[model samples]
Target: MKLSINQLRALEAVVRTGSFSAAAKELGISQPSVSNHLLALEKHYCAQLIHRNGRLAEPTELCSEVLSRIRSVLAMTREVEQILEGRKQLQTGTIRLGYSTYQFALPVISKFMEQYPDVNIEARAMASHDLMPLLQDGNFDVAFISAKSPPPEVNAFEMRIEQMVAVVGKEHPLAQFEMLQWKQLADLPLIQREKSSETRRVFEANAIKAGISLKTVLALGSWGSIVTSVQSGMGVGIAMAGEVTELDNLVAIPIDDNELTVSHFLICLPEMQHIASIQAIFDIASQ
Candidate 1:
C-alpha cells in the first residue's frame, strides 16, 4: 500500500493532539482536509486507523503500531531536507532556538546575527523545563538554559555560571542590607518560583545547606508574577542576578553562598551538534 507524507502527518497529528479539530489547528489546514487525509489513508490500507472516544479520537491498535514508524519517517524526512539545504553552506537558513533566559541569549544571538546576516534566527524565551520537551520533539534546533542537569536526549555545552540573589521591595526590612545571609531569609516570607523553576531549585538547595527550611509564602509560575509579588510587598523573591531586570522599586541583593551559581548550557539534540549552522553558532558562543 502507498501512503503520502501529508496523510502520515495528518494521522500523527490527530493521534498526538487527540482530536481532528486540534490537529487541523496545528497543521494549519481545514478540519475537513484533516478528515480527508485520514479517510484516504485508511482506504488505501483497508484498515481503520482511528475510533471515536467521546469527543476525542483514539488511535486504533493498528494505528498505534505504525505511529512509531511514522514519527521516524517524518524525523528523517526533515533531516534530509536540512541536509539538502546545508549544501548551500551557512549563508542562508533558519535556526529555531528556545531559551530559558534572555539576558544571556540576547547577546549571543546579537553577535551571531552580525556574522551571518542572511541566516534567520527565531528565538523564544520559555522556561527551561518547557524548552527541553519542545527540543526533544524537534520543535527547536537549540536552547540556552541555566539548570543543574541537561536532559538525557540532548548534549550540553557549558557557557557561563550565574548566581542567585534575593530581591525585596525598596521599603522592605531586608532591603537595608547590601547582601543577604542565608539564615536571614529563613524567617522572612519568600515569593518563590514554582517547583519546576531552576532558580527555585538552586535557591532551595542553598537554603537546605544553611539548615533552614525556606518559608515560601507565594509560589508563582512566572518571573513576572514573582516580580509583582515582591514589588507589592507580598514577600522576598529569588532570581539569578543577571536575569533580573527592570527593578524600579526593588533591590536584588547577593546571596551569601558562592556555590549557589547555576551553569548556563547550550543544549541541542546530540546528532545536531555537527551541523554546520549549529556548529557556527556554537563556535561563536565559545569565543
Candidate 2:
C-alpha cells in the first residue's frame, strides 16, 4: 500500500505523545486503528518508525531525521485550509480597483468596506483613458469608468448615465442662466480637464458637431484643480453633472445638447467576476 497522510500523522502523534493509547486519544481514533496505521506505514517504507516499551514510545533514528519535515508539511496543510476557508467566507482578501472619478466609485467602495471590513482595498484614481488598459493588464480587479460603450474584452455593468455640464464660479456672468447652449461658451475662456478626460472628449465632440470652436484656456489633471482654478475666477470649467459641490461657490449649468453625456460602468475581466471580493463589490454596486 502507498504511504498516506493518516499513516504519517499517526506515526508523528505516537512519537510526540510517547504512547499508542495517548496518540489514539489525540487523533480521535482507537489504539488498534493507530497501530494498524503505523504498521502499514512501517511496512510500506520498510523501516520501523517507532520503538515501543510498555506504555512508552520513541521515534527510531530514521524517523527522527524526517520528523521536522513531516511537521512542516502538516503545518502547510493547515495553512492552506485556513486560506481557503477565509476566502470562502469572504473574511480575507485584497481587491485592486481603478477609477476614473470618485464621484461614482466611492459610494460603492464605502458600502463594500462597511460590509467587509476585514478585506483590504487598493483604490487608484486615474484618467478614464488610462483605466481600461491597466485593468486589462491585470493591474485592477475591477474598474469604474465613463465610456460610450463597454470594451469587448471585459464584462461591464452600467452604473449610471451622467451628463456633461458647464461649471462656472458663483460670481461669473453666465452662472445666473438656468441652462446654457454650447455655442454660448465659444467665446468664453474655458478651463477644462486634461485631454484624456472622458468629460472633455464628449464636450469637444459635441462642440465640434455644433460647429463651435472652444477657447480652452487651461487643462488641469484633477477635478479639484479645475474647481480651484474656477473658484479663483481663472475661467469657466467643464465637468460632469453632480460632480460640483453645492458649497464650492460654483454653479453646474446643464448643457442644452443631450449628446453631451457618458455612461458609467463597473467592469472587470470576465473570468475575475467570480472571485469573492470582486463579486461582493459588484453586488454592492448593482444594488
Candidate 3:
C-alpha cells in the first residue's frame, strides 16, 4: 500500500515515544495498528526500517534515514496546516480600517462592504499620523492613508490616484475665470480643511512658493462640510476633482494654470496578502 498521513503520524509518534505500544497509546490506537503502519512504510520504501530483539525495537541505519524523511514530510504538513488556518482566519475575520478622510474612504468602503459580505470591516476616521499607532499595535487590519509618513512597520499601496481642485461660489468673480495663480487665490478668501490633511499640506507648500500663506476664512473638519459651507458663500473649499459629484448647487473650478495631485494609499501588514479574504478585497479594488 502507498504511504499515508496516518502512516507518517504513526512513524512520528513511534520515533518520538520510542516504542510501538507508547505510540499506539498516544494515538489512541492499538500496538498492532502501529506495527502495521510501520510495516506498510517499510514496504513502500522497499527498505528494512526497524530492528527488534525480544521486547525492544530500535532504529536501523535505514530506519534513521526513514525517520529523517518522515520528519521532513511532517514539517511540510504542519506548514500547510498553518497556511490553511491563516486562510480560515481571513474568511471570517474583522478588519479595522483607519482612514484620514471620508471623502476618499466612503466610496471605497461602500464598494468593499458589498464585495466582502463575510468580512466585517470597521472604519474609523483619524488624522493620517494618528492611524499609525493603531496599525502598529495590530488593532488595525489596514489603513487608507496619505501624505504618508514612511514607517518601517507598515506596508502601503497607492489606491486612489487623484488630483486637487479649486472650488468657487457661483457668485464669486473667480468663477468667471478659467485659470488663476496662487497669488490670485490670496486675494480671495480660501476655505481650508483641518491643518493635518494632505490637501492643506500641498496648499501651504504652494502658497509658500507664491510668497503667500493659505488665507483661510474657515477651517472645517470634513471635505463635504467645507464644500457645503463654500456653496453657502462661506469660501472656496480646496478638494479632489472626483469628489464634486453634486456640483449643481456649487462650482468646481480647476486650479488656474497649475496641477496638484493627491494619491490615497491602502496600507496593511506585509503578510496580509496570504489572507484569502484580504487578498480578495485587494484584488477587487485593484481591478
Candidate 4:
C-alpha cells in the first residue's frame, strides 16, 4: 500500500528467482536487502507475499496479483524514459504539417523552413475540413486550415483572417474594375476549386446569396489550376488571399459579403506542441 517501485521490483525479482540469494545476485543487491524488501512489502500489506518450501521461494496468490501491476508500472517507466529521449531527437528534427492550396500556406511554410534549416519539415497537401482530424489523430503534428474553431479536440491558432476574393488576369476586361457586382460575375466562366474545398464553399454561399447562378463552372482539381485557368484567360477564379495576387498578371478584389470571409486556422493536437520543432514552427507560421 505504501511501498516504493524499487521495493516492488525487488520483491518481484525474489519471487522470480525463487531464492533471496539468487534474486539478490540477479538484482545486484545483497541477499539481506532483498529480504528487507520482501519484509517491508509484507509488513505494508500485512500479508504473506512469498513462502519457502524446501530451499525454494514461491510467490503467493497476492504476490502474483501485485507483480502483475508492478510489471505494468515498470513498463510505463520505460515509456517515460523513451519519451524523454525522443524529445532530444526533436531538437533539430522534422515536424509534419498539413495544409490546403487555397491560402498562401506554401510561402509561409517555405519561409519558415528557409529561416530554420535545422528544423526539417514535411508538408502534406490536404483539405481544410480534413486537416483537423488528421492532426488530432496524430497523423500530422499540425496543419493549416480555414476554420473559425478547431473543435474541442484540437488547439488552434488563428493565423490569418482571409476573405474570399474574385481574381482575374490583370489584362482581362473585368480585372480593371475596382468593385464587382453579383450580376457582373454571373456570366463569366468560374474557375473553381473542387466542390469539397473551402474556397468553393465560400463562393457557393456568395453565389446563392447574390441569387447569381452560373450554368457552367470549371471545377478544377487544385487551387493552382484555377489560378492558371484564370491567368490564361479561360475563366475567373475566386480564392483566399494568396501571393498570386502579387503577380503582375493577376488582380485580387475582396468580396464584401459575409459569405466570403474565412479565418485561417493553424491547428495542432495538444501533445505535439511540446516538441521544440513544432513549437518553433508555430512561432514562425504566426510571423
Candidate 5:
C-alpha cells in the first residue's frame, strides 16, 4: 500500500503542535479527520507513532526518528509544487514570513510587494529566538532573525549589522555620553525585552564577560514598550541602533563593546530558496 501524504501531514502537524485539535486547526481539517489519518498511519506500520498524554501528543521513539525525514519530505513536496507554480510567472501565492524586528524586514517586504502585488504575505512578529524554531518547523517560509551566527540548516542572507545601544530619557546623565561601557550601565535600573529576546541575551552575555552585574527593573515584551518606559524615565533600555527613532525625549548612546553587535539575516530552508517568490525576497533584500 502507498503511504498517504495526508496521513504523514497529520502525524507531523500533531507532533509539531502537541495536540490533535490544534493540529486539526493548523491543517484546517476536523479533529476526527486528524485522528483517523494518524490511526491509519499507525495501523499501516503496525507501530504506535504517537503517545497521547492528556491533551498533549508526544511522538513515540519511532516517530521521533522519522519526523525529521518526514519534514524534509513535506518541504520537498512544497518545493516541487512551487517549481510547478513558478512556470506561471509567479503571479499569485502566499509567503509565510516571520520576523524578529520590522526595522529591516519591512523595507524588503515593501519592495517585494511592490513588484509582486498579487502575492499575499502572512507576516508574524516574534522574538529572534522564537522565529528560528518556527521557521525550521515549516511554519514560516522565510524569517528575519538577529544572531551572531546563522544556523547550519538554513541559507542565510545578511540583512544588516546592528549594534546594541543604551536608550535613555534626555534628563538622564548617561544621555550626555557619546559611548558608554558595560560597567556604566551596571548602576542604572534597566528596562529590557523578555528573557527569550536575542538582544537581551547578547547584552547580558557581554555584561557578564565584562564582569559587570546589572539590574533590570523592568522586562517589557516589545521594543516600543521599552522605548516608552525609557522615555518616561522608568529605566535605561537596551536596543539596536536602528530601533531608536528621533523621539525628542529619548537618546541612543553607543555601547563601547565589540561583541555588542548582532547580524540580522533573512533566512529560509535551503530547499525552498529556489522558489520564485522566495528567491525574489532574497533579491530584494540584497539590494
Candidate 6:
C-alpha cells in the first residue's frame, strides 16, 4: 500500500488538534480535504484510523501506531531541513535548548557558544517536569534535566553528577561548618524548590531514607527565590553545589551522606539526537 506525505500530515494534524476542522485550519485547507486525506490513508492501510465523537476524532489502535511513526517522519523532515540549511553554511543555525537548574549546563553552553559564534542559541530554564512537555511539542531541541533516570522516550546522556548540599545564611550558626549531616537538618526550617523540581524530589527522597523530615518554611518555584529566602534567614535550603551562586550572604556545606548526588542528564528525542547542532553541543558536554 502507498501513502502520501499529505495524508500522513493530515492524520497527524487531526490527532494533534483533535478534529478535522482544526487540522484543516492548521494545514490551510478545507475540512473536506482533511477528511479525504484520512479516507485515502485508511483505504491504503485497510484499517479504520479514527473514530469520530461529535467534533473530535479519536485515534484507533492503528492510528495510534501510525501517529508514532508519523512523528518520526515529521522529525526527520525537520532534520532534513536543518541539514539543507547546514550545507548552505555550517557556521550558522539555531539550537533550541530547555534546561532545569541552569548552572549544570551553563559552562558547556558557554564553551559551545565560544566555539560556534555564528550559531544562534535559545535556552529556556524551567522545572524538569515542565520542560518535557515543551520538548515533546518540539519547542526545544534538547533539555538538560536533573534526574536519576530520564523518561523512556528520549535518549539521555549523563552529563554531570552533583551531591546535594545544605545552604544557609552566613549569619546562621550552621554557616561555620564545612560539612553537615543530613540529620542535622531536622532542626532547621527548610526553603525548598517547588514539588515539580527534580532537586526537591531528589533531596526529599534521600531525606526520607536518612530518617529526616524537613520542616519546610517556604516552597518557592524558582531556584533564585529559594536562595533569596535562605539569604533572608527564612530557613536553610537544599541545593546542588554547582547550583549555588551569589554567595555574598550564604554558604554551601557538603552533606556527610554521599547518597544524594543528583545526576544531570542531557535528554532529547531519540530521533533528533543525530542533528549536527545537538551533536556539537553533546560533544562539548561529553568533554
- C-alpha lDDT score of every prediction, in listed order: 0.81, 0.84, 0.70, 0.71, 0.87, 0.83
Candidate 2 colliding pairs, count: 0
lDDT per residue as tens, model 6, 187-237: 678888878888889888888999997887788877788877887888888
**Order of the predicted models by TM-score, top scorer first:** 5, 6, 1, 2, 4, 3
Model 1 agreement with the true structure over 104-212: per-residue lDDT tens digits: 8888889999998877899887778778877765578889988976667677888888878998888888888988888788878988777767888888887888898
- What shift in Å separates residue 124 of candidate 2 from its native position after superposition? 0.7
lDDT tens per residue, model 4, 99-160 = 87634577778777787665667888867776765664345767887754456666677877
Ranking by lDDT: 5, 2, 6, 1, 4, 3
Q: Tell me the TM-score of each prediction against the true structure.
A: 0.72, 0.70, 0.63, 0.63, 0.86, 0.85
Q: What TM-score does structure 6 among the candidates reach?
A: 0.85
As for lDDT, the candidate ahead, 2 or 5, is 5
What are the per-residue Cα lDDT tens digits for candidate 5 across 33-101? 999999988888899999999999999999988886787677667656755786564565688999888
Lowest summed lDDT over 10 consecutive residues: which window, candidate 4?
A: 74-83
* Backbone clashes in model 1, listed as residue pairs: none
lDDT of candidate 1 at residue 59, scale 0 to 100:
92
The per-residue C-alpha lDDT of model 4 at residue 261 equals: 75
> Residue 68 of candidate 6: its Cα lDDT?
53
Say which prediction, candidate 2 or candidate 6, comes out ahead on lDDT.
Answer: 2
Candidate 5, residue 193: the lDDT equals 83
Ranked by lDDT, the better of candidates 1 and 2 is 2
Candidate 3, residues 10-90, lDDT tens digits: the string is 877776666888889999999999999889888877877667666567778876755645654654465456457657433
Residue 2 lDDT, candidate 1, scale 0-100? 71
